[model samples]
Target: MRFRRLRAIALKELLQIWRDPRSLMIALLMPFTQMFLLGYGVTLDLKHIPVCTFDREASQNSQSLLKHFEASSYFAIARNVRTYPELISAIDRSDCKIAIVVPPDFSERLNDTGTSSVQAILDATDDNTANIAYGYAVAIVSGYSNDVALDALGRQGGELQQIQPVAVQSRVWFNEDLDSRNFIIPGLVAVIMALVGAQLTSLTISREWERGTMELLVSTPVTPSEVMVGKLAPYLALGWIDASFCLIIATLWFGVPFRGTLFTLFATTTLFLTVVLGIGYLLSVLIRSQIGASQVALLLTMLPTTLLSGYVFPIDQMPTIIQDITYLVYSRYYVTIIKAIFLKGAGIAALAVPILFLLVYAAAVMTLAARAFRKRLD
Candidate 1:
């Protein structure tokens, strides 16, 4: 609590961080590395899907149908085959994700019977990709079908009449372009902060034990509160630096829209960083070995934050039991809060619930970390 003692402890910790090459690399370079890697490397939007074409009739109608797939941005015609075995070979060689096949009677059926089916062969290895490809293919075919019907009507009788009982209009809010980066980058803030903060603070007291400086630390007149706060102060500043770096990269470099105010972003980041630092410090106090403390901190912070915080996967899609367990993961609240702030531009009033949970979590972990450390060598 005394400023002089606290300042001395903080200065010592900062000096240690400055002198250690590993700590400097982690604090200075790791944020940029992780942000670029996770931001650009991860995405959900699939485009330029490889497709193979097999036209049995080789008619103008079949050529026209193939043209539709070729024109679509989602489908790229990678191979054209005449025989079924060749089509199968192309698929087996992974030349394509979807195969477009026009039946021999496709044109005849459409001309005479006013109906024809185009077969879509999918590689179901990646079911999600396959499903999306199938949806795209269906949409293209539906549009083509409408075009064909209109042409036939115009030739047979007159102009086609358009009538609709209901028209559905959709307005996309927040992520207008449906860019995954907007949401993913915000969650990355939580992940990166948790990882960097915990990894750094977890080494502080444990480094003292490893270097035989515990006696010096114990003999100091500073209380446990002063030592803990002093040790965490430097890391808290590093955490802020990393957070600001991530926000800048997310908004400027990656073009992820940051709709939230600066105050909301930094305020929540501080609370989240406190929880991360406390967890690391608690582990460092409990486990005296530096390597052991660092590993334990990774296990406690990184894994849970990535897996349980809805970073890449949707929580509702998870098993009911797993979804329930996510409530205990503090990063989940921070992730949700940051995403809301970034995407929805949510204010403090709208974010009260998650912020309250995060505040309680920060207070609880700091309490445990403070109590876990003692002045004696037991």
Candidate 2:
């Protein structure tokens, strides 16, 4: 039977893959290891941000305000300085991320004028962290001020019973907790897939050439299409298995929500693997050298997936030329699709453009890889 021959070739390739310990590691262990390291290591949540304070007044009110900053889980008061110069030294030495300067008249001014001012100096070397810390400080200060106002009003004939102003309530959609991991883990799937799929196949056909097995394979009854399919089958199955492991780790271990259907996830992953594997096969056939194929695969697949796929950075903020170039990166489309499925619970209709692009890319690359493979055999 035709199926029997194809199965035999697939099993042979699988055996070859199994005999190579490094390939087994890459196929089985690499994805989960990368996911674990990246998931736990990469984070945007700012916590325990060190701060130094200079309380010139050293009054009850100023102390009360300082206590709030120290109480917050977001901030930690590293040291209390006596002078502005000491505060500056802490920031300059990277001992603190923020510096609080409570004016000498802080308590007196608040008691007399019902208001007081405090200055916060931030180290902006890490601008994103600085901005987030600043926001946290503002929110704490605002809540303390509101408490002070309420206390004052309560003492004054219970003015709190009078008409209250409108209050604004904020609601966050999708990632309701605003967890950075929720956004990051989904995009990482694309990057890991690119690295694993491309690197694995990048050496496959090249290894055949290097081992001088191409001549033997060429003389077989297997057609080029059959050969390509048989070669791709085991790796494709491995890719899916790796993807499943990633999904499990992301959702259960990392606690990232999976909002889309399993069918959609599997479908998109299949299309993406097709694109990357085709690219790897094409490079392997053309170069006929494992080292060259690997370098080219890393350059084309891994680098682009990491940088241009909008995985770690925002594509919109990039230059127009760079953004235009990203359109050609298949990982870009897959990243969008994965993120939407993970975060937005997007259905097929919602992600038609990206799906279409992935389809076109897979078709084009597979066709080209087939041609290159046949020519190389001849």
lDDT of each: 0.92, 0.90
Residue 353 of model 1 has an lDDT of 99
lDDT tens per residue, model 2, 217-335: 87777776677777888889999998999999999999999999989999999999999988888898889999999899999999999899998788999999999999999999999
lDDT of candidate 2?
A: 0.90
* Residue 348 of model 1, lDDT score: 84
Residue 314 in model 1: shift from native, Å? 0.6
Q: What is the C-alpha RMSD of each candidate to the true structure, in Å?
A: 1.4, 1.9
**Model 2 / residue 126 / CA error / Å:** 1.7
Error of 2 at 42 (Å): 1.2
TM-score of each: 0.96, 0.94
Residue 173 lDDT in model 2?
96
lDDT per residue (tens digit) for residues 228-329 in model 1: 999999999999899889888988999988888989999999999999999999999999888999999999999999999998788999999999999999
lDDT of 1: 0.92
